[model samples]
Target chain A: MADDIAGRGDPIKTLQLMWGRIEAPKRGPKSKLAVADLVRAAVRLADEEGIDAVSTRRVAEAVGISPMSFYTHIPDKAVLLDLMLDAVARPADGSEEAQAFRPEDWRANVAFVAREYRAFYLRHPWVLQVATHRPVLGPNTMRAYDYFLAAFDGLNLSEVEMDLSVTMVANYVHGAVRDVARARMVKELTGMSDDEWWHAIAPFLETVDFSPYPVASRIGPVVGELYGLGDPDRAFEFGLECLLDGLAVMVERKGGRR
Target chain B: MADDIAGRGDPIKTLQLMWGRIEAPKRGPKSKLAVADLVRAAVRLADEEGIDAVSTRRVAEAVGISPMSFYTHIPDKAVLLDLMLDAVARPADGSEEAQAFRPEDWRANVAFVAREYRAFYLRHPWVLQVATHRPVLGPNTMRAYDYFLAAFDGLNLSEVEMDLSVTMVANYVHGAVRDVARARMVKELTGMSDDEWWHAIAPFLETVDFSPYPVASRIGPVVGELYGLGDPDRAFEFGLECLLDGLAVMVERKGGRR
Candidate 1:
C-alpha cells in the first residue's frame, strides 16, 4: 500500500486497467471477484471506516479473495484508491443520462454539476486525502472535466478564461463543501453541537474590544444570522451564485457572449 | 489533543490565555518558559514532524518541562494548538503594521491579504487538520476576518452579499492553495515530481479517445501547458481575479460603490 512511486508499477499500465482498455488477467484463475467487485468492496470499506481502513489485504479479505489475487488486479492501494474515486465520480444512480450537460441552460447546468460534485465529496471525504498532484484521469474523471467545460460551450471565453472559470467554480464549491463536511465529521466525532460550543465561547468573545473591528463586528453576527454560522449549504449556494455571476461578467468583458 | 468537547477546559479561559487576557501561571516556579515559548516549540515539532507528532508530552519534552507544568499553561493539546495557530496567524515578523488594511486600496488590500493567507497555510499545513467546526477565533483570527470585511467597506452590498463575497474570495483561495500545498507535501514525501508522473502516464492518456471530450481535449493540454495542471499558485491567482471580478459586478449591480 505504501509502495514508493517507482516501485508502485507503471502508472500508464494502471490507467489502462482503470479505463478497461486492457483485458482481464489471463494468468489468474477464473475467480468470481472481478475488478468492479473489488472496487465496490473498497469503496464500501472507505465509506464505512474511513480511508485509513482501506488496505489491499483488508479489501481482499472483504471480497473473500487472497491478497495475491488482489495484487494481480491492483498493484497497490494507490491504484485501488484511483479505481474507487472513479467509481464514485459519477452520479449515485449509475445513470450517465442524468449527468448530460444542457447547453441551453448553462448557468443551471453548472449549478447542477457543482451541487452534485459537492455531494460526492461530502459522501467520500477520504477522496480529498488523495492529493490531486498527479490526477489519475480515468474515463469518469475525463467525463467530469468535460462536463464542467461543456457549461461554457458558447460563452466566447478564451480557452484560458474558460479553464479559469471552471477551476474557480470548482474551487469555490470544494472549499465551501470541505468546511461543511469537515464540520459535520468533527461534530459527529466529538458528539458536540455547534450551538453548545458557541454558547460556551460567547462570553470570551464579548471581552474582546470589537470596536477596532467595526465592519466585522457589525456584520459578523448578521452574516452569522443569515445562515447558521457553520452551515455550508447556505454558504455554498451563496458562493456559487457569486462565482456564476462573476463568470457572466467575464463573458461580457470578452466582447459579449455568442 | 483528542479531548472531548465538555471534557476540554473552559474555552473562555483558553481564549483569555490565547489573548493574554490572563496572566502567566503563578503556581509554577520562576521558569524560562512563557506560553509563546511553548507554542513555538509545539509549532516547530509539528513542522518537523506532522500534526500527529504534536502531543503535550512531546512538546513538554522539547521545552524541557514536565507534562504537569505544560498543563499549567495549556489545559490540553487542543488549547495548545489554538495558541499555536494564533501565533502563526500574525505576520511572520510579528509586526501588526504588515497586516494593517489600506481602506483606500481595497482591491490591492484584498489581493495582498489573500496572498499572505495562502502563504500562511503553505507554511503550516497542519492548521487544516484542526477542523473549523469550532473555529478558535483568537484576536488575530478576528482581525483577519475584520480585515477581509474592510475591503468592502463601501461596496454598496447588502450585509449578506458583503459576507458572501468575502467567503467566496476566501474559499477560492483556500481551495486553490490546498491543491498546491498538498502537492508539494506529496512530492516531498514520495520523492516524485508531477512532471515525472505525467511523462510516465502520457502514453496511456493518448490511447483514450479525445474526440468524445471536445472541450477537455481541446483545452486540457493547453491548461496543462499554461501552468502544469496541478500548479496551485497559477490557479490561485487566476481564481482570485475571477472572484474579485464577480465582487465588482455585485457592487455595480447594487448601484455602484460608495
Candidate 2:
C-alpha cells in the first residue's frame, strides 16, 4: 500500500519501461500480451480489489499468461508499478483535464488542475495508496508536472515557490480525496452508513458522561449531522478557498497582483 | 494498510471496551494480562512491523499467550484494533501535546494542534495507515477531537463552519504528515538518502528527453536540489501559512475578524 515507494526499482530497467524504451524479449514462443496489457490488467485489478492485489503473478494470471512468461515481459512488481503510475498520469487526450494549462486566470487554472487530480484519483483510487514522493521519473508524470506548473506561468513567483505552490495544492487534494475515500470504504466494508452506525452506538454512548468534553460533545454531533462523515465536499471547498485566498494575499504582498 | 477502517468492529462491545466497561471474562482459568497489556503489545508490534502485522494471533504470541486464550482478553482483531487506536490516542500526561487546550490565540492554537498531530503520527506512523473515517467511538478519540475544537473556540464561524474549520486543519495536517512520513519510509526502506538515490538514477534520467515539459524541466531539478523527497517541512509550513491566511480572509469576509 503506502509502503510501495515509486522509483525504488532498478532505475534503468524501470525507466526503460516508463519511457517505452524496453528492449526486445528473450527468444522463445512469445506471449501475445504486451507490457501495456499487463499494466492495464493490473490497474483493473487494483481498481476492483486494491493496490495489494497488483502482484506480478496475479496480474499475469489475469492476462491469461503463465507467470514465467510474464517475467520476460516485466522484471517485477516494482517496475510494473512505475509503469502503472506513469500510464495513469495522462488524462485522455482533449479532455478538459488534458487542457489544464491556461496561463490567464491562474487561480481558476490552479483550481482546475486540483479538480482534475481529484477526479483521476477517485477513478483510480489505488494510485492514492502508492507513495509517488520518490518522484516517478517518466514521460507522462513529467508531462503532468509540466502541465500543472504551466497553470502558474502567469503568476509572479520564484521557481521554488511555484514548485512549492504545486506541492500545496497536491497535498490538499490528497487529503481531501482520502477523507472522501475513507468514508466510502467504511460504508462499503461495514454495510452501514455513518448515520446508521452512529444510531446503533448512541444508546451505549448515552451511558457515558460527556460533560468533560463540552466542545467535542457539542461540535461532534454537529459535524456528524452535517457531513455524516461521508460527505466532506463542503469542508474541502472551504479549505480550497482559504488556501487560494492565502496564495493571492502572498502575491499581493510581493507587489505582483492584488 | 489504509484499508483498516476504524469503528468497523461490533460497536456496542467495542464502545463498551472503549469506555472501559468490559464485561467479566467467561468462566476460565484467567491469564494474567489486562486488555491494556494486549493493546500495548499490539502497538509495539505495529510500530516495529506494520499495521498488517498486528493480527490477533501475532499479538497474542507477542504477549506470550496462546491465540485461543487471547480471545478471552479481546473478542477479535477488530476489537483489538479499536483498543490500540484509542490507547495511542492519548498523549503522555503533562506533555506539551497533552496540554493542547489553548483558547487564547486561535491561529497559534490551531497550528499547535496541527503540530501535535504531526508529531504523534510520526512517532506512531502506522496510525496513518488505518482509515479512521468511521470514527473510533472511544474516549481518547473523542477527547482529542473536542480538545482540537477548543483551539477554534475564539473563531467567529458558524457551527458547521466551525466543524469544517477543524476538518480543514485536520486534513491539511494529515496531508502534511503523509508527505513527511513517505519521505522517511522511502529513506529507511531503500537504505539510501533521496539525494544518493537520485544521484544513482541521474545518469539514466539524462537519456530521457525533457523538451516536451519545459516548465517541469526548469522547476523539477530546482525542487530536487532544494528539498529532496526526504524533506518537505519548508513546503508544509508554506502551505500551512497559506491555509491560515485563506481562512483569515474568509473570516474578514464574514465581517467578524479583521
In terms of lDDT, the best-performing candidate is 2
Q: Write the per-residue lDDT of candidate 1 for residues A8-118, one digit (tens) a residue.
A: 556776687778877755884676767888999988987886665777888899999887779877776667777887887765675543656655666787788788778
**Angstrom error at residue B226, model 1:** 4.5
Model 2 per-residue lDDT tens digits across residues A5-102: 43445767777888788766688776677888998898888778777677778888999987777787887676777788898888666777545454
lDDT of 2: 0.75
Off by over 4 Å in 1: A1-17, A20-38, A52-61, A64-79, A94-100, A255-258, B1-17, B20-35, B48-61, B65-80, B94-105, B256-258
Q: Give TM per candidate.
A: 0.84, 0.92
Q: In model 2, which runs have C-alpha deviations exceeding 4 angstroms?
A: A1-8, A100-102, B1-8, B98-104, B254-258
Q: Model 1, range B5-101, lDDT digits (tens) per residue?
A: 2225657767887788876557847767788889999899777665657878888999998877898777876677778778877656745445666
Question: In order, what is each prediction's RMSD in angstroms?
Answer: 4.2, 2.7
Encode model 2's per-residue lDDT on B131-220: one tens digit a residue.
554568688888788877887775677767778787888888887788677667667666777678778888888787889999888887
Docking class of 1: acceptable
